[model samples]
Target chain A: DAGVTQSPTHLIKTRGQQVTLRCSPKSGHDTVSWYQQALGQGPQFIFQYYEEEERQRGNFPDRFSGHQFPNYSSELNVNALLLGDSALYLCASSSPFESGYTFGSGTRLTVV
Target chain B: GESVGLHLPTLSVQEGDNSIINCAYSNSASDYFIWYKQESGKGPQFIIDIRSNMDKRQGQRVTVLLNKTVKHLSLQIAATQPGDSAVYFCAENPSYAGGTSYGKLTFGQGTILTVHP
Candidate 1:
């Protein structure tokens, strides 16, 4: 009965470096969506993946991309990161039959 | 652009007092709305939700009221406690609803709620 699990609870990276965050969806869930929350701001949708393919995306740039594995796990990869990329990255999972989506504690990315 | 926003940036209240958080949404077509509470250094936690078809829905100590005509939403907390101090965000799902269509969410700027004892 574990909820969503995200790896690398915290990360520090340099500008222009790349980072990949991992997420394991809750049991009995199939859809995974990634979001970015800046300081003192609500989360902004980055993208969503279903059936191993990206079903929808937000207004983020090409540098932001994601992948959904057959096991329903997900990975969010950010390339050419900038200091503005420093924020909390959250992963949420949901099922079609369920109305509520469970979110992980999130990875706090600090770009130095 | 579709967006959701709260009326206030911050609110302070005495513990055991009722608290109401208001939000205004730009998308009239949005059918699903949700409220999330996030503690420091943690992800947003789901509090409650209400669909357009319903005017209000109540959870244990929370109540979400939807005003479709005005494109507004509100979350009411009964007898707030210190543990309720956190940032609250109201999110709208503009995509198709029901089944698996629940996709990426558009969130507001969030409101900081401080409950004092």
Candidate 2:
């Protein structure tokens, strides 16, 4: 089965600009979660979506948002990007709590 | 918030040797745990997982051990190969009421493993 897939393997944006990343969850999975991984750091949770609604979110500000479609694909949107926002954005898919989540290769955002 | 952490920042071992990476988690309420390995420029790959009720689980050459008494978890790689070089992270899933906690993984700061020839 195809694993989680993300679009725009790499991207660059200027400060205060906005960017959107996309992800397709693994086949047969319904839940999608987004994470931000800085260099040499573990990924930090951004938000999670299930049943087409956001169920949980992390400490990120309102600038970061996400959406999940009926097909289980997800999109992450960040407005007014800062240089600190430049990091690897990962998308993970899973079924339910206590189940393992599968990660995507991630989209590397470079805010200049 | 839950805190999952590694005991070492980096570990280097010769090929053919066994490698043991240790982790500590602050959430005793966490019911599930996982180990993931991520190569440079790549996303984390699932290795093995152990539930809070179990002490150990084995997968091929990798093993995960959990000690709830001490809030410790470990991953052991047998006959470590050069391809094993990567960052390893331990993640936790804390329990919650109802269906609120839907398999959200809280990852620890990973440990870098360097297997040399």
Q: For each candidate, C-alpha RMSD in Å?
A: 0.9, 2.0
Worst 10 residues of 2 chain B by lDDT: B95-104
True C-alpha contacts between chains kept, each model in order: 0.75, 0.54
Best-matching candidate per lDDT: 1
TM-score of each: 0.98, 0.95
Model 1: per-residue Cα lDDT over B1-117, one tens digit each: 898999999999999999999999999989788899999988889999888899999999999999998999999999999999999999999775776646778899999999999
lDDT of 2 at B9: 94
Report residue B14 deviation for candidate 2 (angstroms).
Answer: 0.8
Candidate 2 residue-wise lDDT, A46-110, digit = tens: 99999999988989999999999999899999999999999999999886443578899999999
Where model 1 places Cα greater than 4 Å from the true spot, the runs are none
lDDT of 1 at B107: 92
| Runs in model 2 lying further than 4 Å from the true structure | A96-98, B96-103
The positional error of residue B111 in candidate 1, measured at the CA in angstroms, is: 0.9
Best by DockQ: 1
lDDT of 2 by residue, B11-92 (tens): 9999999999999999899988889999988999989877887999999999999999999999999999999999999999
